[model samples]
Target: MDGNRVATLVGFAATLVVLAGLVWVVGIDDTLAALTTADPVALAAVAGIALCWLVSWGLALWTVLRALGSPVSPHIAILVFVAAVFSNNVTPFGQAGGEPLSALLISTAADTEYETGLAAIASVDTVHFLPSVGYAIVGFTFVAAGAVQLTRNLAFAAAAVAVLALGIPVAAVLGWQHRYRIEAAVIRGFTPVVTTVARVVPRWSPPSAASIEARIERFFAAIDRIATDRRTVIQTFGLSAFGWACLAASLWTSLYAVGAPVPAEVVLLVVPVGSIASVVPLPGGSGAIETVLVTLLVSTAPVSAPVATSAVLIHRVGSYLLPTLVGGGVATALGVDHAASPET
Candidate 1:
């Protein structure tokens, strides 16, 4: 096999090993016991929370697509969203895998170029990032309100600082069209290591300077199209924020079901922190997500080691594994090729 294929197989094997370690660490029996002993009413409540999460995500995607002038029906958009979610889970590039799947699905449905669909998808991603800042803002507010505690560890503090630093560009892009003018200035802020790696395998196409400028113009024009309707913009942001809140609630409910007594706000903080840690381009966030979640829970919450471990495992099973299985089945039934899909 080719080197790339061999590397992919190695990565997949590593992912499996990580997942296996998680299962062992969490204790399969204890996890099963937690599930079996969970209160029926609590289980029902968790189910309700999951339903709300699905609806909120669908609404967020629908709002962004509509804002981008590709007015898909709500039902279709929800299906596409679910399929995208599934695609992201099975792919190796973390969340980046889902964007192209979303683009392809929408393009096929709308009978348009993949680029137009991608523009819409990119717009959705831009809108999605805005409300994450809202989460950080809300999380920090809770910390200040004594609803959650901030960690003193230098690493945690550094992560919080990094998250804030990353948010700057996202905020600038969402808030101002002229933010591109500052691209060079912002690019200069990267350290030598980051700058060197960026040059090594740049994510964007290496176009001529003129072509790059034109693409930026196109991106800005697309953003303008979505930004023109103030009401739509507000609604899109609201939906994205609501979706994130529901996701936090889902995590909290999963923990509660697994016998952990974490507060909702603590879940909010932990979820975002774990998410930020798992930003690496690994499939399902692999070991990184589990490590972050378990570590944060041990430090921040009142739960014991076994309980905390079980809770994180259950959360991953519900949020990642289950969705991936369902989404993959749906994609297969729709005649989508896993090997050829952009998400793969």
Candidate 2:
């Protein structure tokens, strides 16, 4: 079986485990009652909007690929994006765990080099960050103006968003300024492995130190290709923001479905913070994401504990679980094999 296909199985099983855990933690009877009593149309809309979120982000990826000279169709871009989501969902630490595999799939599906694919996803992530903070800032502004209120958990969530909005940009700028030093450190770290491989496999010609350097250069070159294009950057950003909107809307709809309507700003605030909590080193950030979302909703919004839990569960079914299943199907249909040689 393909590595990704196997990951799909793992992802499916993990989602079940997470779902079961959620039911147990939140009380199965309450969860069942919430689901049974919820508005079917709004719950359906949650899943549909989640699909829209995927498509929007796929468009963003397509834009980046076209800028990087891939020129794949939007359909293929969505396939790659979904497969990438599967990779992320099945692994620990979310995107960080899945990126290398996702990069491989992107290169394979898009007919681009590995470094270019790597750069595409990395660039997408960098671009995606700002929009998240932008949404959070808008919500935080409402909080400041007395339009919205916060509990202890939500206050902390807002404070964290404030730091992320300020911190990420500064970190990015500093990292870019010192990129050469960082590159040198990376090269130095890899030198011993290259030497050992060369020593172990004398019959085969291993990649030279220059080849590694060139690969790094190409990675940056791909990022530069996208960055240098103002139009492409704008399109990517626009698509990303649209995707974020779809996600927030999905959550808001979920809350509404459960008859726990909250202010729109509450969704704006909670969605981004929930996303941030997704890096908690759990597969697809399963446990942590739900916890953060439920806490934030119950704290900052006019929702009961059980209703808040149900709403988050419903929202995640679309955002996390649905994507995992769909992406897995995509990986299987596409026959993506990350272990295969690029030339094959």
Candidate 3:
């Protein structure tokens, strides 16, 4: 494998070693005992999280599809949603890979124009971020209230801000706002380089600048078209909030299961703050998530290190691992049957 790929694998392995070391230092027997006797209520909480996750994402998908004038049944929405999830979690750099696959699946199944599907998918992501950003803002208050260690909390908070600030939707919006200038800049900046490269490389040619500019215009136009409907925006944002709340409940219950329950406000604050690490490129945020979660739990709760570690492991099983395996199966069963027509 290439150096970067090798480095990623090494990093992933090192994280696993750290987790195992943590468990060992805390005593394997104690950790096992904690897990074996997990609270029943917490087990039941998984069901609630599953429902909320499916419904929230499904509704978001359905809302965008309807707004794009291509409505599908709930079943189809779930299929597409799971497919997107699988693509995201299983792929390298999932967030980058997931959106395009989701948009492609929507276009193929719902028979919407590709640009429309792209816009809808982008909108759903942007809408979800609206609540996420709000939580981050409110999350800082809890941090200030001594919910977590100041340095670690600030680190995670800054990471979240950086992730959102550098996200594609924000970049797209910025580009859209300066469409003409950006388009001109792109051509002016790249044309001469392309021309010189083409001179040296006889078989190579640059893409048509006019085509590139036109596509940019089309992309923004699709976004603007979706923006005309304020109702859909409200609906998607509401669903996102409910979805996020369910996720927080899942984390709380995980803590409760380990007999290390924190305050509700603590759960609300820590979960989102920890989730900031999910932006890391590792599959399912692997090492990154566990580190953030363990830090948050220890800092925010009245639990021992072992208890916090156990709870974080359990939470990840439900939130990341389970969904990834199940979503992969769902995606496999559905396949990519472009010929299968979507229901009206």
Best by lDDT: 2
User: lDDT values of the candidates?
Assistant: 0.65, 0.84, 0.71
Clashing pairs in 2: none
Which window of ten consecutive residues has the lowest lDDT sum in model 1? 184-193
Models ranked on lDDT: 2, 3, 1
What are the models' TM-scores?
0.75, 0.89, 0.78
Cα deviation of 128, candidate 3, in Å: 0.9
State model 1's lDDT. Answer: 0.65
Count of steric clashes across candidates, in order: 0, 0, 0
Candidate 2 residues lying further than 4 Å off, grouped into runs, are 1-26, 147-150, 197-205, 336-344
Q: What is the lDDT, from 0 to 100, of the residue 113 in candidate 2? A: 91
Ranking by TM-score: 2, 3, 1
Of candidate 3, the 10-residue stretch with the lowest lDDT total is 333-342
User: Candidate 3: which stretches are off by over 4 Å?
Assistant: 1-29, 146-173, 179-214, 339-344
